[model samples]
Target: MTQREKAKQPIEADVVVVGGGPAGINAAIAAGRLGARTVLIERYGFVGGMSTAALVYPWMTFHTVEGKQVIGGIADELVRRLQAIGASPGHVRDTVGFVNTITPYHPEVYKTLAVDMLHEAGVKLIAHSFVDSVAMEGDRIAAVRLTSKSGRLEVRGKVFVDTSGDADLAYLSGAPTLQGRDEDGRTQPMTMKFRMRGVDLAKVKQYMLDNPDEFYRKTPIDELESLPLSGVMGFFKQWNAAQLPINRDQVLFFTGPEPDEVLVNTTRVQGLDGTDVEDLTEAEHLGRKQAQQVADFMIRELPGFERASLSQVGAQIGIRETRRIVGRYTLEAADVVEGRRFDDVIARSGYPIDIHDPSGKGVAASWVKGDGAYDIPYRCLLPQRVNNLLVGGRCISTSHEALATTRLTPSCMATGQAAGAAAALAAEQGLAPGELDVRLLQEALRAEGALLV
Candidate 1:
């Protein structure tokens, strides 16, 4: 049979989401709650993209620098559910230094919660499915071509949300897109997150308190010494004489649900574009190897981890950026640093511009002055030259600098929720996503408990 002849019966929905990460999860939930027939497709067998697949623990802070909760709605609901099940411990502030917003959780627990929550919201979840192509009827996406174990199949929808993180659907639909910075077409490094078990929390905490100089913290705030493992930023110098193969500085670890468990964020594979199949494959190998090297160094050099075991590796490497769709509006660095507000704002984010060096040499973080949050306009979600489609997650339109902050988990979820609701409403009104009344969309998001600036 020909490629077209092998096609199966179309799976129809009012809204179709092409990802199962934080953004895709919330998008489907929001769409389904509006009484729209929603379907969520994922590349993996399970949900929770970076969080579960990459073993990335904790949601980045949902608050502004002023300590006000800026990101709520579906994002907050997920955290609350995880906390209720002891999968997460809510949010913690790193007063020792940059006031990092951290909410630690279990990867498995996060995956479970996401799947259950999507099901409870009445969103159909299709796992291990990938969108290979798009069928465009004029400017609108008539159907999405997916290749899975069952072979070629198509999903038809009134509206489509591209939360693929890499803008897969948007790009496949011939939408204009850009990758990395304008300088070299290079993107941020990919990381492999791992966990350490049997960690001696008491011993580690005591050592951190005693050898505060070994670690770096700007101000000594409340609960300083109690933090099991804060930022010991300069521990990397110790590894220099020993000559570890790992790139970058510092051994960053966050406390897990149990005192004896901790999540480690230290592996980085630089100069790899996440969208390229060959590059992504190479990153997965190199990232995991780096993780093993880091783990061995930990047992040999660090305290509290003397008896710790390299318990688990992530399901996949954590991707920071890839193909960013060129949307109606491109958010600039000034928008983030100056805390610019938009008339059709969808979400608020306070994360600094954290750039992981493409050379695998180092990292640079520039904070937002006054610790304020900036707005993501509704236009950013509307991919340019596309009808009945929206882009969410890290793939949204933004300058490289602004993308550093807007791509956070909470920020992605916020955008996902907004895009989903807007798509559903667009379908209900029988209008294209680009033609729908944005003010009404904002009202719908506000009703869904999202905090729009």
Candidate 2:
């Protein structure tokens, strides 16, 4: 018939995962390896969503403040794989003192590894496809409508997972969702991360030594000479003196897989809605302008960047907050700070509540209690009113304060692995994802080396 009619024909799979970021990749791989015919759909030509597209380098805090490795499974697998290929140096101490460890990986290499692992697990990837709508059968999602270079198409699956970061699939399916903070509907500010090459680590370290009070309070001055400069989060004096137009309080940069290269994560685009195209466009423009100014300031003022040159700006702005599905259980600020444990724990994280003010000023942070991590319950992934749909990544149910920590990349991968295993198990049992036995799901994740205590 016509193109519209042709789009109605469905492509079948046991599990359908939307978004090809870290969460989606792990979800699809977990499902595929468990014998499900899994399909992964992404809007970009490559995977590694924020990692590659937004240039959010250095996966942070896979361990607790006590140096205990809390995040594992696919997240750990990805790091090990990168290390095997010499694309990453594995987990290193966080000199910035924001977290316990930061896993630095080559973003280009991550794209390749993600693709290779997905293929090895028998996952079918549909890149450059954006899902805009869904067909519902009662409370369950029957299919999702996708638009791409080839025009329109529909994907039908037994179970659906929304790892779209913004919970796009859940929103399209009419699931109840919450956006931004409770006081105001404003979300955390978006940032554009850029890279600089020819950075002199020795000079930067010496500067830190000479002006210890200018850096983060937790920065270990004595160890600077011995430890790698994995990350540095303070340049208070120079930043304040220069009076850059950017909204951030201090300079923050992370060392990389390359010795001479550093990723700058200091640009903050505040008071913008990440889901709105107009807001996103403005963020992109404003962020790039700030990036250029920041780079110039570094070259002129920062000791380590004397010869450094601006290398690359991210393909997209880094979105820290968006629409989170209102799931059966909403993770709260107390749960994170108190290190709450759940009987149905699927994932755990020790990252703190780090809220970059929506008004574009300072950050409010609170670490996990006494070097302990809090549990992420299975009910958090079960969106209310959606029968066969699951959610992973930063979009899973959580209060605005709690989102600051759960929005982290490593934790997103953990939740994703849980959702994928649950999806495959539910599909095989001919049941909705919520009806799947939490114990069995936990067992499956543990079998795959996931850490859920």
Let me know the TM-score candidate 1 reaches against the reference structure: 0.95
Query: TM-score per candidate, in order?
Result: 0.95, 0.98
Model 2 lDDT tens row, 240-274: 99998888899999997689999999999988899
Q: Candidate 1 lDDT, tens digit per residue, 391-418? A: 8898999998788888889999999999
* Window of ten residues with lowest summed lDDT in model 2: 1-10
Q: What is the alpha-carbon lDDT of model 1 when measured against the actual structure?
A: 0.84
lDDT of 1 at 57: 65
Among these predicted structures, which one has the highest TM-score? 2
TM-score between model 2 and native:
0.98
